[model samples]
Target: MTAQAVIQVFILVLILAGGILAVWLRDLLAAVIALAGASLLVSLEFYILQAPDVAIAEAGIGAALTTAIYVIALRRTRRKEKE
Candidate 1:
């Protein structure tokens, strides 16, 4: 198998594991982090698959923006939980 294929497989496992962890996790912040990790793995897979456009979109929009949104949401939850 090619190097890219190996990377793709490895990243696929990461994505799957992250997804399962996100679902099974009890902590909201940890779930958010796991989801972000899955998104990053998706971005890596896109890069290995040689789709630069998809890679860029996944890295920029899916990973970064989504992670930022989740972080904000987590912060809000923390504030609410504290109150």
Candidate 2:
């Protein structure tokens, strides 16, 4: 395969790993961080795919804005899952 395709596949693997980590973590803040990381990776993937506008939007909204909102909400609440 091409180098670009290989990079895309690597990014996809990282994105999936981040998603899995986010879901597997018991701490809410950690989960949010993982989600943001996944979002950033997705934005990078979009950029590599030749969609700069969409990449910017994803980075801004998905990685930054949403993460900020989640952090604010997490701050207002608790950081760990209650059992």
Candidate 3:
């Protein structure tokens, strides 16, 4: 396989791992971070595939904006207290 193809495969593997970690993590904040990492990796894959516009949009919206929103929402929620 070509170097570019190899790089794409590597990125895909990392993205998969991040997604799994996001699902497996018990902490909500950690899961959000893992999801953001996957989003960034997807953006990188898009850039490697010669889709710079899509990559930029993914990075801005998926990685940055979405993560920020999730984090803010998580922070605003109150945890249940044991009676």
Best by lDDT: 2
Candidate 1 vs candidate 2: the lDDT winner is 2
After TM-score superposition, the amount by which residue 52's alpha carbon in candidate 2 deviates from its true location, in angstroms, is 0.7
- What's the lDDT for candidate 2? 0.97
Query: lDDT order of candidates, best first?
Result: 2, 3, 1
- Residue pairs clashing, model 1: none
Candidate 1 per-residue lDDT, tens place, 1-83, comes to: 98877877888998999999988877778888899889988988888778989999999988889889888877766622232
lDDT of 2 at 10: 98
- For model 2, residues 1-83, the per-residue Cα lDDT tens digits are 99999999999999999999999999999999999999999999999999999999999999999999999999989999887
Tell me the lDDT of model 2 at 48. Answer: 98
Candidate 3 colliding pairs: none
How well does candidate 3 score on lDDT at residue 50? 93
Against the hidden reference, what TM-scores do the models get? 0.83, 0.96, 0.90
Model 2 steric clash pairs: none
Highest-scoring model, TM-score: 2
